[model samples]
Target: METRKLGDSDLEVSAIGFGGWGIGGAPFWSTEGDNASVKAIRKAVDLGINFFDTAPVYGFGHSEELLGKTLKPVRDRVILASKCGLRWSREALGAISKNASRTSIEEEIEASLRRLATDRIDLYMVHWPDVHTPQQETLETLVDIQRKGKIRHIGVSNYSIDQMKEASRYGKFISLQPEYNLLSRSIEAEVVPWCLANGVGIVAYSPLASGVLTGKYDKATRFKDWRSKGVIGTFQGEAYERNIDKVERLKALADSAGRTAGQLAINWVLRQPGVATALVGVKNERQIEENVSAAGWAPAPEIDARLNEVFARE
Candidate 1:
């Protein structure tokens, strides 16, 4: 496994990070038992995955707990990242919303510290921007906390270019985690270039297009998980048919390249100029092993040219 620097920050993380959302379980995503999740995480560390990203909202903190249990033994050997600003109830499952206020950020940081069982967080990011709170105030608080040593570095997720610019005024943002993939590339037109100019590392989530680019779904395929059902709404009707058609073609292309569709997708993302890492969700050790195979390998220029042509026409 190779590593890359995160923007201008001193931290260097693995090219491929283990996403904690899937292991979170429950209404969020389809998951196996806690034991399986723990094994997968430990195996990830053994396989040289140094970056692990999670959020408190994932399984209402269960994901962090599991990660903490597995990684605590090798704490100094890994870079831990988690997000805040999305709060929910403990008694019942409800709509989780953003709260980037100073008070809210302070409270969430303490809770995350407790769940993660660590004194300092490597990269602490605002899971999403808060409309009610000003960006200046939120970032100022993050800077103060970083100075106090509760958080090592500050970053933002799901933030627009303007919002990131505003945040830079108050504090340093070394990375931006955005939903970017073959099917969802609107960010490349603006967000990606903006980050590249400002020295912000791109941490691409859902780089598999929520599994659609993995060649596992078809017109008759259906999802039962709430996260999949809600976030994958675009994968229906005409769009669904068109995407499936494109995937079939891409699969043929991948086979010609001696790769799987998922591996090809990951390779495409890593080849992008500003991308520092791609987060791939894993339910078991098999998924981690499969996703990591894309690392340390670069496809020829012609393959990428053909891929760009295939995706641009969509």
Candidate 2:
């Protein structure tokens, strides 16, 4: 429910933005149904969430369509965000690859517009860094479209400090969307500092450590989805076991504090400096309501410190 300026941009995004990945639901996640997803989005808005972030590859465009139609009536009141760069040869998740090329973006923007049923995207981002393409090409292309009014602001996701440095030389970005949470704080030492110094806001993704921080999984729980494929984040081997150990400690501490693990996780991410918003992917109305509640509250100082110690990786 708390709104903050995204980096240096004038766009006031909610502290808890609606992450559209889960609603898309396919190779990555399962969903109740399209009707449930639509209801979830509306529920988020009713609860004061105004920023919605999605990508073309999310359900291979299903997410955009659902968001486009569901939020059409309240378009002016909310901020719609979508990403390019990560493209797929087919509808399958395995076929997805990074392609931030000029031609690819030009083609992608048009398609996204059509699917989203909007003339301009509030925030357009490169989903991931395309090492093969020059940073200038991607940034300039975004700038060109910015001038043409296709996207209101430019952002980069899953980018490293070095990658951001290279990309910033060409054009300014208002935000950096990185994986930040209790179990994942790699950005704390560098990326967070860089964003604060450069005047870029941090939009954190996977704030719940992909549900591990929600206290629903254990060391024995093996994910059958993309988490097992080593695509992103820590989900296999001894590393996962260590993460689970920390999560267990976090769960106990969060429970004693009279808060759900998910709420605690989201609150911690929002408290971090340089973070403008924390994106929570919801699949139903209940989920959105819970996530939105995390926005206006915080744990006591002692509980917060205990949580930090529980999930500290460094």
Candidate 3:
């Protein structure tokens, strides 16, 4: 696997990292058990993936606990990145809103440490922006944590360009996690260019367009109730079906290049500048293997050009 420097920080991570959103047994999605998830994670490590990204909100803290147990033995061998800023209660399964209060952030970090069974997190991030709290207060708290050596580096997820600039004013932000894929190109307007200029690494999530680019779902396919509910279902409706046609066209390009559609999609994101790593969620060992193999193969220039043409038409 190829390794890239994480922005301006000293940390270097694999070009492809494993995301732990689906491993926590959350109510919103069907996921694997602890043993299965751990097996997948271990397989990823064996395949040379050194970066693992998770969050406290995933499975309402269950994801962190699972990650802690599975990766504890090889903690030093990998770069662990987790997030804060989402408020969760015992009765709730998802994050209520963005929160950056001193007490709240501290409590969340302590809990994450306990679950991760680590002395310090390699990359600690604010999962989302808190409209109520000033950025300075939140960033100062992060600075305090850095001084205490609780976190090695700081990052922000889902932050806009102006918000990122404000954050850089407080201290150095080494990374930013955002939703960037063939289906989602909004970040190209400003976020990608800004990160390139300012030297902030981008950890791209949903690089496969939530399985749409994997060539698994078609017009006749029916998703689970969890996928059909709320935003997930609404987003996967007609527009998604239409987008799948574009995916089908791209799959032909992948075939011509002798690569899978998923690999093609991931490589498209990895080819972009300022991308430190692309985070992928896997449910089984085969998925992990397929994703890791993509790193070894690069698409030809013609395939890359064709992919851009297809996306442009979309």
The lDDT per prediction is 0.87, 0.90, 0.85
10-37 per-residue lDDT for model 1 (tens digits)? 8889988899988998767767798889
> Per-residue lDDT tens digits of candidate 2, residues 278-313?
999889998888777777777888998888777775
Clashes of each: 0, 0, 0
Error of 2 at 133 (Å): 0.6
Candidate ordering by lDDT (highest first): 2, 1, 3
Which residue pairs collide in model 1, if any?
none
Q: What's model 3's TM-score?
A: 0.94
lDDT of 3 by residue, 1-314 (tens): 89999898889999899998888665645775677788899999999999999998888888899889889999999999999998765534443677987888999899999999999999999999887888888899998998999999999999999899888888778999998888887788788889989889999998887677888888777766345655432246678777888889988998998889999899888888788899998878889988887775678888888788778723
Ranking by TM-score: 2, 1, 3
Judge candidate 3 at residue 181 and give its lDDT: 82
- Of models 2 and 3, which has the larger lDDT? 2
lDDT of 3: 0.85
Angstrom error of the Cα, residue 113, model 2: value is 0.8
The C-alpha RMSD in Å for every predicted model, in order, reads 1.6, 1.1, 1.9
lDDT of 2 at 158: 89
Measure candidate 1: CA RMSD.
Answer: 1.6
